[model samples]
Target: MSLNFHTMHDKNPDIVASLARLHEHHFGARPTVITGLQGDGSDRQIFRLSSDANEPVIGIYGPNRRENEAFISFSRALHQHAIPVPIIYTYDADAHIYLESDLGDVTLLEWSNQHDDSSSVLTMYRQVISWLPKVQLTSKDSIDYTKCHPFAAFRREAMQFDLDYFQSSFLSRFLRIRLDNAALANDFNLLIAHLLRAPFDAFMYRDFQSKNIMICNEQPFFIDYQSGRKGALQYDVASLLFDANVNLSHSFREAMLEFYIRETMRYIPIQEKKFLTFYYDFALLRMLQALAAFSFLVFQKGKSYFMKSIPNALQNIAFLLTQDDCMLRRLPELRRLFEEDVLNNPQALS
Candidate 1:
């Protein structure tokens, strides 16, 4: 059966059709329907295809050329190194479509949301950390830090998001206040400088939050991990622990970090004190980036979900800012910005 490429809401039909053809050619039967799944920070779309009762399921991804190529290559490389990513069945590079074995139904986000006690959730997350050292060891030679954008680039992206969305929409349109405050801009610049100067580098998952991880067969399975690149080693750790969506407590996060350190030591030797420094610096950077993201989503994307999480994002940033000496120096300005724009502004708080 043929499917229209444009009729589907958020996917490229041409890619979908190509994937259908590829599946039919390989499996000798077409999928019943391509059901859309939640997406991440890219223009890619994911779909699951269910086959006959006796046959296994197939996972299809429609990513752009660069991302699609990287995922296909990375999956193969990681698979060779015993990482638990989805097994790729076939890839049609010309059409930007690839098929992989379905891991299972439950995502870490869904699993965590369902359980009242977070112990089981943390256990599974610890398993994920166990896998990271292997990921680091295997991909060490393959990971290209030069290809990965640096903290400086991230700061630029955040500023663009702020200027285009938060400053233009919220400060000007919503609050009727022109964003001509030089002092506020300077404070933001200082914060950006602090982030860029922070130290650390390793394979970064770019987006290693709960939602991107799946719990298949009671194990933490990673997804939306195609953006993995050379970055601060602690970036993923900070992303997972200080996640605005999951809201894990400080005590739990610290324990988890300790757990990660112990497990990572099994494969590689890392100094406890030096690793902690990276962890703190990366945490501060991640928090700042998230602050920019929350602001962008609310003011530019008109997303109310992100708006609700703004306070939590700010709190995380404040917590991290207080921990580091470099960030501590800029705490007064940061507090001023938060109070004036976030806390005191009742409308934004809402």
Candidate 2:
């Protein structure tokens, strides 16, 4: 006798099918195809769903539901404040799929890269920087920090996270060098303590760089701001100026800093000297965090794209190391390790 067995159907929901459904609901029909866009550090998968009926919309499929929630909530809050973030259209809370306005393919970095004119590039940068103070200071009282991803503020814990992350991902994994951990810890504590005292009340765009700012319709629009939270005002500016991938010139960076200070004064009272002092300290911290992320991507995760950024990140660190008045000079062992194991080693170019 011949016997046949019946197969059981799977219960798990199809995310692509859900996304298609969402497209249909929004666009009157499902898109012909969903093309994926290149992503940054996050694990979120982004798709551009397009059809003839309407403009294309961006579909975001993120693994972490809470992270997606944070972004959606934050985007709503920012939009409510009249900030230039992409307008989020719909969200399927259960499926962790969300749709938002497609801000086009060009980032500020891409736009700047196409131009050979320094004046035009600097103007573009100034335009973008002008929007920052609005994000930081405008509608200042309404934001709910609890909606911020991972944490509410860049407090001591946050600083320590960057320092420890650098130690693990760069110092230990990439360089394969041993250092005086106790001494480094003391230095870390000092740096954190110093940074913690900077103006921590502003909305810091934790990773504010050219790549995160999109250029659409000849205007600057911000993106990738899910990591934003309460932190020192100087950190975001530092991140943009010291961005390893962008490799902004020292003189250009200083010019932008001065412009930022002048713009900042219009919104709030600021002592230029004090802000500059804190700015250098924050710049050092941002460089360390960036190096950690680059090393983590290149060495630990085997992503070669980040390898190109290593030299510039190290150069920024070297520049900071030379600053006689910077807090980084106090950390002798940390300085020595970066100099000997990282700067001196030709293998770092790999």
Error of 1 at 41 (Å): 4.6
Q: Assess the local accuracy of residue 90 in candidate 2 as a C-alpha lDDT between 0 and 100.
A: 91
CA lDDT scores, all candidates in order: 0.65, 0.82
User: What is the per-residue lDDT of model 1 for residues 272-328, given as tens digits with 9 covering 90 to 100?
Assistant: 887674566556556656655666565666665777666676677657655654353
How many steric clashes between backbone atoms does each model show? 1, 0
Per residue, candidate 2 scores C-alpha lDDT tens digits across 203-277 of 887889988999999899988888878888899999999988787888999999999888988999999888877
Deviating ranges (above 4 Å) for candidate 2: 1-13
lDDT computed for candidate 1: 0.65
Q: In model 2, what lDDT does residue 186 have?
A: 85
